[model samples]
Target: MSTAQPDEGTDRATPDALLHTRTGTEVTPEDVVLAAGRDVTPKNLEWAKRKIETEGVAALDKLLP
Candidate 1:
């Protein structure tokens, strides 16, 4: 007789999980704008830049996590 084990090699991602994977780490201004539900325009990019400058790492954390 042989025992079969569950397969853990392949991973599955839910829609919510996909959002995190797509973003990953290494925050970008475009990411910030999108996370904040804003369009990726030049003005939004500049705003995101200032946000990153002021908040640093916390910016992405606040937006994502």
Candidate 2:
């Protein structure tokens, strides 16, 4: 992720633009939080990173809508 900040009205660093910088086919942790109408926190980002490392990216689909 870049050193940029989330746009106004957000509570975390990972904004949708930064979150979607990678392949558009995958849903990032930030996207998950946005889907739930919440802000992405450090803990959430950590959890998502951990899950991806432990279970692989495909495992993330289970947490998506």
Candidate 2's residue-wise lDDT over 1-65, tens digit each?
67987788887567544553335577567755554455689887777667666766554555553
Which clashing pairs does model 1 show? none
Candidate 1 regions with alpha-carbon error over 4 angstroms: 1-24
The top-ranked prediction according to lDDT is: 1
Candidate 2: residue pairs that collide? none
RMSD (Cα, Å) of model 1: 7.5
| Whole-model alpha-carbon lDDT for candidate 1 | 0.80
